[model samples]
Each structure stands twice: as structure tokens, then as C-alpha cells.
Target: MGNSSSLHLQQEDVQAIQDETGFTPQQIERLYSRFSSLDKAGKSHLTREDFLRIPELAINPLGDRIVHAFFYESKNGEEDKVDFKDFVRVLAHFRPIKKNQEKNKLNTRMEKLHFAFRMYDIDGDDKISKEELLAVLTMMVGQNICPEQLLSIAERTIIEADTDRDNLISFEEFAKVLERTDVEQKMSIRFLS
Candidate 1:
């Protein structure tokens, strides 16, 4: 109620925010500090400068703008009360679905990804050539668990999986597909639903 940094935010607000936003504690601290500094009325107010200043906040995946807007509205009393629950709601709007960053990171199953890469090394060429192993991979497609890429899937999956352009699927590269725990979890949710 007072324009004081004395308003020490408890951990519940932070925990709830993190649960909703998937933001690390460090990020939350930085954000909280930024907002706390804007005690315009002993109330609170986020200015356009605040938005422009926090360069790390991105609107793309997390909808950072929405979170900022909510905070601004609550602090300025332009909206209703500024409860911790409200903060959670704001964070939820910016929450990152798991595996988003990792999807681009290195492979989870370095060995397996490598195996998938070399799995199509037909003609015992020791590497998957661009020629496309129709017979060998096609035969194993339905049989194997993940199965080989049967040319088309192989073309895309390989290209997507291959971080480097060495024209081979090393275990390091192949593990990326298997390491998507977040995606796998979501798939499980859909299955049960």
C-alpha cells in the first residue's frame, strides 16, 4: 500500500509465478527488482522505459508483453487489486512450455541420435549417403520401434536432426529427437485425455 521497497514479496508469489511462467528464480528476481523500483505512488507503476529496458524479455514464446502489462496495470491501480494470485495469472500468460529451448539445443540421447544417423548407412558405406537407402530402411520402417526414415521421413528427419552439415547422423545429432521429454510428456497427456 505504501510506496516502499519495504514491500518484501514473499516466496509464494514467486513460486506461483515461476510455476506459471517456467522462469528461473534469477529471472523472477530481476523482474521483481525492476518493478519494485517503480514505486511511483507508494503504489506502483511500470513505464514504457521499463519495457524498453528489460532487453532479455521476449514476446515471442512467453508473451512477455502481457505479463508486463498486467504488472503495470495492477501497480498503477488502473485495474483491480494487485494480489499474488494476479501475479500468477500474469505469469501464466508468459509461461514457456517445456522443451522449447531444448528443441534447439544439443541432443539428449547422444548415442541414440548417432545410431539413428548411421542406421541408414547402407552399402556399408559407413555413413548415410544422399542416394537414399530405399530397400534397407524401407524394410525396417514399420518393424523397428522408431523405424528408419524410408527416404522421405529420412530426408527431413535427418536434415532436421543434423546440427552440422557433415551429411551423417552421429549419435550426438540423433539424440536430439529422443531427448524431447517435454514433447513426450505432452503426447502422454493427449493420450490419456
Candidate 2:
């Protein structure tokens, strides 16, 4: 029947998204609509400036770093444009979903932590050095933070998260930070808001 064929096509489309993004139909549809709105002109892609206009992004403490990561660090070769696929891939980590959490507890937490780690890493070195954290905190507070104050803040953050005292925050250390109840709650509120 034609109806059955159309249903089959719909199912296939969902499956394709799942295969590509590791998200289900519901998440894909919900986030796809959200991403599509960022295009503004219905162009099916977002320029760097367009991506920054996302309301949540505009107000986020890590807005500049996040925008930089999504637009420049990912290096998908699109060059100043994030297509629908890029949006989905990046947000798949940041956007929390109950169903996904239920399926993989470790994965959900790791993904969230990984997003944070990537934001602070800045140099893709798989570790957050003092310079990286300083840069991030400096950006968050603007240039008003004096060099001494910024260094102290960065050192304190590293000391708290760097369990092994390796002078860097590894993913394990970063995950521990995410696991703290207060930090986790704040993260949920920040992103899910």
C-alpha cells in the first residue's frame, strides 16, 4: 500500500538519523526543529554569527568558547558554516535526554563532561593546562580580571579538579567535577534551561 510505503520511508529516515547521530527519532525531531530555527533564513545551515544568536548560547557563560569550538575547532571543512549534521553531532552531547540517560548512564555523564572538557581544552591536547583554564576564565570574566587574579583562579580550579596533581585536568578529573552533586545540578539547570 502507498501508506505503508510512506511509513516505511519515515522509519528509514529515523533510522538514518539514529545511525548518524546516535539519537532516537524523538530527540532527532525535537533537536532538528530547534537547529532549523537557528538558520533564520531557512537556509538549512548556520553561519558562525547565526549560531551565536541562539538565545541560550548568547547568555551562556561559555558562549564564546562554545561558538569557537563548534565553528572552528570541529574542523568539518564547512568553513564558517554549520550544517544540520554538524549541529546535531555537537548538540547530541550537550542536550540531555532522559531516554538516553536510562540507556547509558556512564555515556551520558561522560558526554556532558567531555563537552565541558573540550570547551576548556582549547588546544586539543586532551588536557586542560593552566593556560587553557586561564584563557577560559578570563573570557568568562572579560579582560577586567588582572593577571595575578586570573592565575590564582586558574590554579585553584586546577587544584580542585586535578586529583593526581599532574598540573593538568584529565578527563577523569573532569568527570569527577561533573559528578559532584552541586556541579551536576548546576550543569543540568544551565543547559536544560
Highest TM-score against the true fold, candidate:
2
lDDT of each: 0.46, 0.69
Instruction: Please give the distance, in angstroms, between residue 160's alpha carbon in candidate 1 and its true position after superposition.
Output: 33
Off by over 4 Å in 1: 1-7, 44-88, 100-193
- Model 1 C-alpha RMSD vs. true structure (Å) is 17.6
Clashing pairs in 1: 3-42, 109-175, 110-171, 113-174, 113-175, 114-170, 114-171, 117-169
Best by lDDT: 2
Query: What are the candidates' C-alpha RMSDs?
Result: 17.6, 4.9
At residue 26, candidate 1 shows an lDDT of 60
lDDT minimum window of 10 residues, candidate 1: 184-193
- Scanning candidate 2 in windows of ten residues, the lowest lDDT window is 183-192
Residue-level lDDT of model 1, residues 95-154, one tens digit each, is: 333555432112223322332344355444555555544444554444453544456766
Task: Please write out the lDDT profile of model 2 over residues 32-148, one tens digit for every residue.
Answer: 667766778977678878977878779877887888767653436876788766766665554444443442332256666776788888988899999999888887887787889
